[model samples]
Every structure is written in structure tokens, then in C-alpha cells.
Target: MTSVPTVPFHDGQSIPQLGYGVWRVEDDVAADVVAQAIRAGYHHIDTAAIYGNEEGVGRAVAAAGVPREELFITTKVWNSAHGYDEALAALEESLGKLGTDYVDLWLIHWAKPTQGRYVDTWKALIEAQRQGKVRSIGVSNFPAEQLEEIIEATGVVPVIHQVETHPYWQQRELREVEERHGILHESWSPLGQGGELLEDPEITAIAEAHGATPAQVVIAWHLAKGFVVIPKSVTSERIVSNLAAADVELTEDEVARIDALDREDGRIGPDPATIEF
Candidate 1:
């Protein structure tokens, strides 16, 4: 098995460069899926309150036999819970559902700019970190401006920013901002969500040349670009294979070729600027 490397955060902790996400995974089966992922060499698992599967995820973590300190578990606060008091309560509820005293990282699921409470929520996250309830704190689908606002308002910087990123919807501008702030960039829909890019002639050709699947090549591209990639799958073969993709080496030319796939109109997820949810 190939070893997945860890990326350093500005806050003195590191996260696995590759992990498994339980976004659309069913609650009834999330335990088995997460356990299988752990058996396949994944020490990191990403989940959230909105996913409706934290209880199952906690069960898997407890039964996987891996020590609590060895696993990196992350969860998020949903859009509805956006104020300081609500965010604090939200983390407690998530902890109860997850059956854990603390989470490795916690994120505000979305900016919800219309409501304009992300800043207050972020302050709550800072409080969590200070209280030692969360080791790290961040936001998902947040634009650079929002990131800056929270950082300027409070000196704490996010350790990571989770968003929809792929060869098509490459967030070059957002990546730059994260780099400036020393925040790790995390790819949510790293595989393009079954889009045509998965079957594109270029990706297939690259896969054929590398003797790997298009999915593996795409994941390898994400790692080669230094972004944390979480590709989810319930199938046993795919779960194991995705973890082994850490070893699929890509050349400079191949990485650059994939980089060219980014398009201004290629965003498959909602625009962070206007997204109310």
C-alpha cells in the first residue's frame, strides 16, 4: 500500500493529503463504508451535519479499532446555524451525534452571505479552538473576500477551505488566496461529479498512458497540484483503488495538460459569491 502524505497547516497541525468523504453516502451504510475506507488505509474521513450520517460515521470510527488519536475526523456547521451562540450549540450537537469529544477540524458549510452571519460563526469556531473542542477551524465554499473579512476581523486564519474543484471547475483565483493565507485548499467534487470531463479524450488518453483509470489520474492530478483531495466511493474496489492513487505519479507535462482543462464557464457548483445557501 502507498502511504498518503500530510500537509502542514499554519496552525501547527497537518491533515492527510488524501481522504474519504461521506457526502451523499447513506446513513445506514456509512459505518461500513467508512470502516472499509479505514481498512483500505484511509485515516481521514470527512462528514457534516447536513450529510445526515454523523452517527453512522461515529459508529465506524469506534468499531474500526484504530485509536482515536490516529484518525482525523472533520465535520461542519450547516447554513441554518450561523450565529455565535448557534454555532457553539451546533458543534455540541455534532459532537453528540459523532460520539466524540472533539473533532480534528470544523468548518462553516457555506458563506450564506445574504444572512451575513459567517463572521459571527467564525468567532464561535475560534472559541471552539480556544476551548480545545476543535483542533482546527475553516469554511467551505467561501470566496476570498469572505475569507479575508473573517481573518481581518479576527486574527485567526482558516486551516483549510473546502470547495468544488476539478479539472473543469479549477478555482485558480481562490487557490491563490488560500496560498497567500497559508490555508490548505481542499477539493470537494474533485472528480467533476460524473461530468463529461471524466470521459474526455484527454483524460482517457492520460489514463491509458499511465495504465490507470481516469478517476485515478484525476485524483493524482489533484495531489500533484498540492491540494487535499477527498474522493468518495462505496464500492470496495474503488475505495481501495482511490487510496492507492496516491502512488500514481504524473509527469510535469501531464500535470500541466490537466491544468489547461480549467475553464471560466466550467464551474459545476454554485457560485460562492451569490450563493444564499
Candidate 2:
């Protein structure tokens, strides 16, 4: 299997470009699904306490027999656990559930500005990284203003910023801000949360040109743009097909054609700024 290139973090670490996201996957089925993803060549697995499938992921990780160092594991501290001590405790709990001593990447889940404690939680993450409890630290769903606030308050730029990104909602301006800070951008809904991007005429045309699936074309677009994408799927065939995207190369013009699909107002998820928690 071809390996996807890794993007460096602010802390001088690297993360695989293509990963497996276990979001919305039920606990009962998460282990088998994750095992399939691993068998399909996914080395990076993204999960969180809020997902409620950490134990299953742990089982799969152990069962896969892939050495711990060979896999990149990431999890987040949920919004309800936003204070310093609470965040620390939540990390311990997550570690327990995932059957790991330290996570490769730990994130602040959400800005949770309404809670007014993300700064405190970020401080805890910094300490956790220093203690080697986490190899890297970052934030998710952080807007530019909130991200700046975190940097100014903690004097630590996030290693990466995970956000809802797809062709329709490319987040170009926010990505520019992240680039200014030398932070990698990781896309959560890399496929538009199961929307029609995979079935769009433009995507289909590109896929037909490459003799690949529309999903492969979409994943190729993300890879070409240098964004880390964690696409989720429980189906064995889809998992294999998604990983096979690493081999599908898109020409610059083809990428440009896909970029034209971006819309100024095409977000498929809730705005992080307005989310209550």
C-alpha cells in the first residue's frame, strides 16, 4: 500500500494525510469497523469521548496487532469537560477506554466559547503534551477569533486545527489563517457528511476520467489540497475504495474544476460559533 504524505505540526510532529474517522459509529460495531479500516490500510484513527465508542476502538486496536507506534490515535475532551481538572480527568478516562497510555493527538474538541473555559482546557492540554501524555495538541471547530484568543492566552499555537471541510465548504479563508500560524488543517466532514458531492456530475465526470469512484475523486481533491481528511465508512468495500484514493492522481486542471464546486454559503454542519456546547 502507498503511504500518504505526512504534514508537520507546530511541535515538529507529522500526521498521516488520510485517516479513518469513527464518528457516529455505534459502540457495538465500532471495533469491527475499525478493524476493517486498519486492514484497509488506515494508520490514523480519529475518535472522541463524545463519540461513545472508545472502548470498541480500543478492542480493535489491540486486536489489529499493529504496534502502538505504528498507528496515530487521536481523541478529544468533550465540551461538558472543559475546565482544567475536568479536561485532565477526561483524558485519563479516554485513555482508559481506548486502552492507551498516551494519545498521538489530543484536541480541545470545540471552542465552547459559551462555556468560557476552552482557554483553561487548552492550558491543561499543553501540560499534558509536556508530560508526554499526548504527543501533539490542537483544537477543533475553532474560528479565527477564538483560535487567536487561545494562542494569545496560552502562547502556544495549536499543532493542527480540525474543522468541517469539504469541496462545497472549502474554508479557504480560515485555512489561510491556519497556514499563517503554521498549523495543519484537518478536515472532519471531508466528504460533506454524506451529502451529494460523491454523486455530483462534476465529480462523476472527473471519476470517469480517472476510472475511479466519485468518492475517490473527492478524497483525491482533499489530498491534492494538502488537507488531512478522515472519511468514515463501515462498509468493507467502501473502506478499501477510500484508501485506494491514494493512487488516484488528479491533474491541476482537474483539481481546479473541483475547486469551482465551492459555494460561498454551503456549510453542511452547525456553525461552531453558534453551537451551545
Candidate 3:
């Protein structure tokens, strides 16, 4: 098994820099798919209640034969669960679905700023962490302003901020804010969900220079920049190849070349500030 490298969170716990993400994966197929990821050397798994596959994921974990402590699991509460009480209840349901006593990381799936209850949801995450139901708490799709508001409101900084980021959308400013706050930046759609920029000549050239796949080069770029990256794939080959990216290293110049691919219009996901659900 390939030993993935880990990034240290402020809480002194470490997370595998590379992990598997199950976004649109179906509940029925999630177990087999997740089992494949485990066989591919991936130790971290990212799932969410919105994905509708936690039960399959739970079954896979129960049968994978790896000790629970040897794996890292993460799940998020959906938009409806935006208040403190709802967030806590949502976590319980997720735990029931995931068949795990606790998750390594639990996150507010989205700020859902329009609802104005993320701060309350964050408070629930804090309580869960304090009660040992979650080891760490974080948020997803949260912009810098929302991140700051929650931190200021609760005096608790989320250990991570998972967002839509790839070479084409590096999120430089958001990353800067996270760095200043000592929060880890976790990348979703890390390989460009639609294969955006995966075929760029610059990226291809870098791949050639490093004798690696374009996906590996892209994943390596995230790691070089100190971001936790989870690239989703149900295909067995792609799953293994994604984890193998931990072995690929990019030089400063190569990394810069990829960084230059960032564009103002590169965002592939919804704007966090305006999202209602």
C-alpha cells in the first residue's frame, strides 16, 4: 500500500493530503467503489449527507478489514440542518448511516449564507467535537467573509475549508485568508470535474517532464501548495492512480506554470455567497 503523506491541522492531528471523494456516487455502488479506493491505498474518505451514499460507505468500512483508526472519514451536514440543534441531530443521522461512532472531520456542508444559520450550525459542530462525536470541525463552500464571521462569532476557527479548486481556479485569496487563520485548505473538484485544463499544453508538458499522468501532476500541484486534495473517481484504475499522486513531486517552476493557469472566470461551482441550498 502506498503510504500517503499527511498535513498537520492546528489541533495537532494530521490528515492525509490525498483522499477519495464520493460526490455523485450512488448509494448502491458506493460500498464497492469505496472498497476499491481502500485497495488503492487511500486512507481518507470524504462523503456528505447530500451524497446519499453513507450507508454503502459504512458497509465498505465495516468489511474493508482495516482498523477504524487506520482510516480517516469525513461527512457534512446538509443545508436544512443549519441551526445548532438541527446540526447536532443531522450528525447523529449521518453517524447512523455511516455506521461509525465518530468522524475524523465533520463540516458545515455549505455556508448557505441566505439562511443566515451557518454560525449556529458551526456551534453545533463545536459541541460535537467537544463531546468526542467529531475529532475536528470545518466548513465547505465558505468564502473569506463568512469564514471570518463564524470565527469571530464563536472564537473557534474551523480546521479546514473545503472548496471548489483546481489549477484553473487556485483560490489564491481564499487560500491566503486560510493561511493567516491557520486553517487548512481542502480542494474539491481537485481534478477539474469536467476535465477542465486537464488537457492544457502547459500541464501536459509538466506531466511529460515528470513522467506522470496529467491527473497526478494536477494533484501534485495542490500538495506542493500545501492544500488537502480529494479527487473523486469510481473507476478502479483512476482511484488507484489518484492516490499514487502522492509520489509525484513538482518543482517550483513547474508549480508556477500550473499556477499561472488560474483565471478569474475559472470557478466551476456555485458562488458560495449567493447559494441558498
Candidate 4:
């Protein structure tokens, strides 16, 4: 298996450009799937406390005999655990479940702006970093204004901002904001949640040009654009195929063609600043 390149984060550390996302995988199945990914040369695994499968991930990590430092493990604190103390306790719980001493990266799962606790949550995340519970801290689903609030309140810039990004909803404006603050942009739904992106003529054309699949074209676009992408799949064939996407190369014209597929009205997830807890 060929290793993928790593992207440096705001914390002076780096993560694999491609990662495996365990969003909704059941705990019973997560371990084997993770092991499969590891065997396929995936060095990064993205999970969340809410995913309820940290133990499975832990088991796989332990059973694989892979050194902890070689694998980058990331998990997020839930919206309910937003305060300083709650965040600390939640990190401990996550650590316990994952059977690890620390996480490579930790993040606020959502802004939960309506709950009016994200600012405090950001503070808690900073405190967690100071306490050595998490090496790097970031936010998920944060808009520009909310990101500004956290930057102003804590004087710590997020390492990455994970959002529902895909070719359809590119979030160019938000990506600009993230660049201004030196935060890495990560896409949560790079495939548009099984939408028509994989069947688009432009993408298919580019894939055909490179002897790749439409999914590979989309993943290559994300990597080329400097966004960390976590594309999820449980099937072994798809998993292996997705890992192969790193080798796909798209030219400037092909990238521009995929960029043209973005639609102004193609949002798939709720806006963070407006979602209810």
C-alpha cells in the first residue's frame, strides 16, 4: 500500500491527506472496518464522541499492533459537553472509551449557536489543549462570524474547521474565512451524501481521462484544493477504491470543470449558526 502525503495543521503537527470517517458505523462493525482501513494503509481515523464506537476503534487500534504515534486519531466533543468542566470530563470519557491517553485532534462537534454555549465551548477546547488531553483543537460547522468569536475570545485559532462540504456546496466564502485564520478546511460529505456527483458527466469525463472513477475524481479534487476530506464507506471494495483516489491526478482544466458543477442552491446539511441543539 502506498502512503498518502500529510498536511500540516495549525498546531505544528500533520495528518494524512486522506482519512477514514466513522460517522454512523455501528460499534460491532467499526473495529473490523477500521482494521481493514489500517490494512489498506489508512493512517488517520476520524470519529466523534457521539458516534458511540470509540471502543471499537480502540480495540482495532490495539489489535492491529500499529504504534499509537503512527496513527492519527481524531474525536469531537458533543454539543451538550460545551462548558470547560463538561468538556474536560467528556474528553476523559472519550479517552476511556477509545482506550487512549490522548487524541491527535479534538473539536467542538457543532456550534450549537442557538444553545448559546459555543463560545464557552471554545474556551473549554483551549483549556483541554493546555491540559494535554488533546494535542490540537478545532470546530465543526462553524460559520465565519462564530469562528471570529472563538478567535477573539480565546486567542487560539482552530487547526481545522470540518463542515458539510462537497462539489455541490463548495462553501467558498467559508473556505476564505478559514484561510484568513490559517485553519485547515476539512470536508465531511465530499461525495454529496451519495448524490449525483458520482454520475455527473464532467466528473465521469475526467475520471475516464485518468482511468479513475467519478468518486476518485471528486476525492482528487478535494486533495488538490488542499482540503482534508473524510469519505466514508463500509464495503471493502469501495474502501480500497477510495484509498486509491490519492493517486488520481486531475489537470487544471479538469479541476475547473468540476468546480463548474457547484450549484448555488445545493446545501445538504443545516447551517451551523441556525441549527437547534
Over 1-277, each residue of candidate 4 has an lDDT whose tens digit, in order, gives: 6558899997898888899999999997999999999988899999999999999999999998899999999999998898878988999999999999999999999988777788888888888788887889999998788899889987899999999988898999998999988999999989986558888888888889899989989999999999899999999988889889999888988888888888999888887979875
Tens digits of per-residue lDDT for model 3, 1-277: 6678899899878899999999999997999999989877888999999999999999999989999999999999999888999999999999999999999999999998889998999999999999999999999999789999999999999999999999888899998999999999999999886665788999889999988999999999999998999999888889988888888989989988898999899988899999754
TM-score between model 4 and native: 0.98
Candidate 4 — which residues are off by over 4 angstroms? none
lDDT by residue for model 2 over 1-277, one digit each (tens)?
Answer: 8677777887878899999999999987999999999987899999999999999999999999899998999999999999999999999999999999999999999997777898999999999999999999999999888999999998999999999999999999999899999989999888885558888899999999999998999999999999999999989999889888989999999999999999988798889888984
Residue 29 lDDT in candidate 3: 90
- Deviation from truth (RMSD, Å), model 2: 0.9
lDDT scores of the candidates, listed in order: 0.93, 0.92, 0.92, 0.90
Worst 10 residues of 2 by lDDT: 1-10
What candidate 3 gets wrong by more than 4 Å, as runs, is: none
> lDDT: which is higher, 1 or 3?
1
